[model samples]
Target: MTTHPAETVHDALREEPCEDAWWMPGPDGFAACALSSSARTVAEARRFTRATLEGWRLCSSVAEDAALVVSELVSNALRYGAGGGGKEPAAVCPAWLALTRQDGTVLCAVSDAGTTAPVVKVPDHLAESGRGLHIVDQLSDAWGWTPPDRSGKTVWATVSSVRV
Candidate 1:
């Protein structure tokens, strides 16, 4: 079995909005719950990702990669999807992150109010920010976007299960 840092996991769970975020029995013999949240800033995005990954008992390397992907996705939402003016906003739309486990894969999904789909651009050294999805494309086993039934779109990526 994979041994994780218990104290860190507990602390992160305490901060989640829902007690149970993602839960499913692992094919290998274990269960995991992944909780996610969203932020208007890159810093908050990183914090939320770190907390969720730690809570899920992801290894250091996987956690780091997941964090980076979350940062990019959240940043894109704040920039294009949500009406974040970068200053004090009169109102903010609900943005969220969700984790789910199915078929021995851990899926990380981010939802936002924007209808625009993410496009993977060819890597450009001079461009400032279009490379986010490109990186996600390379790291995740599979990634895509979907429109929610009510509103908004969800972009999701999958990671192979670590359970043993």
Candidate 2:
């Protein structure tokens, strides 16, 4: 985790990531963390996303939605991605959570070794699963997944800086 100077929540939310108000090739407004496929992953991803957004001066504006979306994405990855069936070794199931700010949008992406594409399922009210993508769809401006390559596939969602 990167530590930045403390600023007022309002000021931070209104501020952009870089000095010239543009994203460079580096960590101008990007943060990422590895996640384990355990019960604590959802909470860890939420904390990491919220903190990174706060450091980027976007917490007050989109933190709630971003955190929720991050949890959903990470949960799906843990449950369905490679090594998710509780049999594979952790080394074979590497996963990561990434955050980036670009052109007034915050992008949250989760990458995992699993090759299965994510799908949105319609479940009954009492069903315990299959609603992750639904919540992500409702909260994000846009969401999609990339096909798995040698490294793995990534599922991403975008949230506008300005609230809807």
Candidate-wise lDDT, in order? 0.57, 0.72
Superposed by TM-score, candidate 2 places the C-alpha of residue 110 at a distance from the truth, in angstroms, of: 0.2
Give the alpha carbon lDDT tens digit for every residue of 15-125 in model 2. Answer: 332221111122478776666555555876786677777667765658889999999998888777846334454354357788899756899998887777898898667
Give all candidate RMSDs, comma-separated: 8.3, 8.3
lDDT of 1 by residue, 61-152 (tens): 66676677777777776666654233222133345655555544567677776666777777789987689888887777778899543366
* Candidate 1, residue 71: how far the Cα is off, in Å: 0.8
Q: Could you tell me the TM-score of candidate 2? A: 0.75
Deviating ranges (above 4 Å) for candidate 1: 1-40, 84-90, 102-104, 148-150, 161-164
